[model samples]
Target: MKIHLSYGKDGLDVEIPERNLAGVLSFGASTPLAHPEEAIARSLQEPIGSLPLGELATKAKSACIVVCDITRPVPNKQLLPPMLRTLEESGIARNKITILVATGLHRPSTAAELDLILGQSMVSKYRVVDHHASVPGEQSLLGETKRKTPVYIDKRYLEAELKITVGFIEPHLMAGFSGGRKMVAIGCAGEETIKTLHSPRVLDDERCREGSIDENPLHDELMEISRMAGHDFVLDVSLDANRNITGVYAGHPQEAHAVGVEAVRRSVRATLKEPADIVVTTSAGFPLDLTYYQSIKGMTAALPVLKKGGMLILAAECSEGLGSERFTAMATRFGTATEFDEWIHQHPVDIDQWQLQECLKAVRQGEVVVVASGIRPEHRDKLFVRTAASVEEAVAQGLQKFGSQTTIAVIPKGPYTLVEVSRTSA
Candidate 1:
């Protein structure tokens, strides 16, 4: 197996045994392939002249903000500067513009972190505000959909004459990809709207497999409801394992997303056969590289394919503890997803019940779970799953259970965890 890495603009490949689960691991879009600065340059190189929204901004009479999703590793370097330049060229002054960090229910990015993400120039030039969806009451809805569902938008976004959303597209667990309707779900709306959009009416239905973009339940509705809201323009990019922009689409939300979706279909998704006896996976390295919360998406992608009581070996280096405070709080508070579902039904404040449930479910299904992570020994020992210090140890443990009958599924760097199905002739 050959594993490729990028330090700067250069690519370095490391080869390991095809059967060696120890060294050969393939990561997703979490890593950076194109240099961030260069990716930014490329996005800037795009001719924004054809876009209706860009044209609208060009002739705008007042100011509008460029609200870029800073969640995960959005190509912010490629996202902001050119947008500002374009908006500025359109007549909106840099000072009049604002950048909102759509934190939604996630932890807010610090000023230093924001500076690191948006670059010092934009940080110094314009107001960079973090959208606090923590307080649901503070948010406002733009209008009601035909279904009578209110299209909640960030109050600040409504403040501007034109609102622009920018984000990176990747295989997402709930909403298919990140960019399409994510802005409406997490960026514009309050928690109530978020929950409403994602609640039982949205979840508790037939779910699409993690890598199944077209079939995913949440992804289906998000697209419908987002179009209801007047999302002016959208810019989304499909990135490779190294966070390199493999594709970029900018236009009316659906059109742009369709273009991006088509590209992602060719490049990202993989299919697998079901019912593996032993599954080994890494924490979808990079953004999910260092955190337990972010890494859980890999497990969600991997789990449904496992047979009953099948062992799942998770290799996540959760060095940053849990990524978000709320993620940690919910993971520990509820014993199962059903319990969280019931709890959310009663509470009615949080946005992601399905997320809470999956974590708890994963925790409770410890009989089938094994963790070979960078977490401390004491912590690993205490976690619900059986813990191994290294990959060889994890695989060896699985071998003990099945001897030769065990079928091993290896997903190195495991977001969009792929399951392989093959009818090999005996």
Candidate 2:
């Protein structure tokens, strides 16, 4: 059987023998929108739970539109033009509108990346700036949540008379799902605010897992922060496996995001009859798999369908290497996975530590075999995982460890496809 997995830009297809396959887990197929631009315009015209964006823009002196950074697959190019036009048509001058890249704790997008993200026309025409989380003085402190998560958002985003956020809706490892409030709470938050949100205490909560919302404390707190940050409006899209926009949600951040979440839930949720002895997955490729830190999402997503002692074969290009210097430093500070866990339990204050801890949790589940061209031989040992030159070699290693009769499950879109073992099977 030939299984095609999402890899950098173009995708990767590997041939696996049918005899060893258990089942290929993937999201339900959804037809891509025939007219995404029209859909986006229509959605903005009749937004949920509020007046149309044009009407709202009329009252504004200035506007700040927050967009996802390079790490996300948000269709900024398609979404931004219509939004900018809406604001402009309402008499808001182009200079009064600023586009803020919600980098969170991630690095700033470069000039070429900015052009790719927002199109050269938009980038050159509009005043686009990257959020600097490290600069606390530049942020406005918007009180605390019930969980006492200090919400310090970018002053530009907070000070805007008209605040709008543009993002994609998808299952997230920590926030249940991404988009909406997340764009303000975490995306535009300062470094300390981000640390508080991703702290071990919050991340350890049971409800913090994927596809959960109603009772998710993390999600609830983020919403609280969003309210405090005064997130006026949001435009979120749901995409199919091929990155085509399938649905668009606009208007009130909470209301519109909920709609987008439901749409995404239908596309990505999958159920497995039983845990697999070996699970093969990818990090959704290209922009998302650019770094190992971001690629950890694939490992966490596989946990629900992975046997206690199963082997996880992860394929991520990671062309950007470790991605986070802090995360790599944390990994190097500990010798073993257990030590890493212990350290996190004691000192969970650092940025990106939570991700490393998640990586350690996956390590405790079983052995992790990684296949990536960018990872060096020396770095493999430091990452606490076995390295392979290709997915075929990793699968061969898994077969050797688990024996020929081992059940194998493949997740082609990785974190994009959420798999949960059926309760009956569990």
Candidate 3:
């Protein structure tokens, strides 16, 4: 079997294993990404036509708040050109438009980082500011949820006459899929409101154990919050392995986001359904494991498809594992979910963060586990059966222990595991 690789926009091709995967199964054969820019442009064109960003901005807009996806690698750099051009044509002047980095509790990106995501030219002209979640006064508490989660948000966003959200569509740790309403929900939402959703109780773990983004309650709530927030229009993007826009969905939040989901599902989802005894995989790449607060998706993908007591093999490069100090502190302060929640019952903070501690409890038992990543060996020992250097090695170890009769499932990226959930269910 031969796997092909190409660099700098040529295309990627992987020779399918000729040997009958008869009992063996591999889902996504590396295929060429043909006319990527054109594909993205076409998807975007439809929504651009509908919203007519230029026309709307030219009309009654006082101040425009352009909230950008400031998370890790997805800085909206590539899409910013055309999007800015549209805004300019639509009549919103550069000065009146304020660029917001919608980082909801994550550390704010620095000036150089912002320039990298939004290019030097654009960053120079537009007055941009990073959203501060820990700080007070700048952002206002819109309200609290039934669960008593507070919504800390960028006050400027609500005040703006026209609001434009830009982000890339990908798998999210909490949300089944990312983008569109996701921007308003987790991206720009306040800590309390987000906690109401992110907390283990509200998380859609068991609900979509074998379900897709469509059926997930987490995504459902995002849609609700986004609608109430009136995000107006969104430019949601989907990228290939190299972070190129393989698909772009633009328009009102609900309308075009589905396109992003399908495009990513094609390239990123697991192919086979039969339970695998030895599964070898990676984190599905970056942004998924940007930090542990964000790393759960990869685990979600492999968990459901494994047999009743099958072994799971994971290869994740969590170079920056557990990215948040608060997140790490929360994890260590409590021994169990019950204790964790009890702690939350008393102490008051911006967001109700105890829910994530609860979400962590679901994986304590079941089948055997194996992991090889940048995370500490102690952590691996605590979570998995073993850890190895490579996928082939992991598989070999698995076969030695579980026997060759076992199946194998591989996911290059864990974040997009939702695709496999539905396939496994089917």
Index of the highest-lDDT prediction: 2
lDDT of 3: 0.57
Task: Mark the regions of model 3 whose C-alpha exceeds 4 Å error after superposition.
Answer: 1-49, 62-75, 144-150, 208-215, 262-269, 332-373, 376-397, 417-426
The number of clashing residue pairs in model 1 is: 12
Looking at candidate 2, the ten consecutive residues that score lowest on lDDT are 326-335
TM-score winner, 2 or 3 = 2
Model 3, span 260-304: residue lDDT tens: 677766656654545555444444555445454454445555565
Give lDDT per model, in order.
0.59, 0.87, 0.57
Candidate 3 or 2, higher lDDT: 2
lDDT, candidate 2, 302-351, per-residue tens? 88888898999888888878777776676667667877777777874888
Q: Candidates' TM-scores? A: 0.80, 0.97, 0.78
- List runs of model 1 lying over 4 Å from the truth: 1-53, 62-71, 136-138, 143-150, 213-217, 273-275, 323-326, 334-353, 360-386, 416-426
Residue 307 Cα positional deviation in candidate 3, in Å, after optimal superposition: 1.7
* Global Cα lDDT for candidate 1: 0.59
Clashes counted in candidate 2 amount to 0
Best model number under TM-score: 2
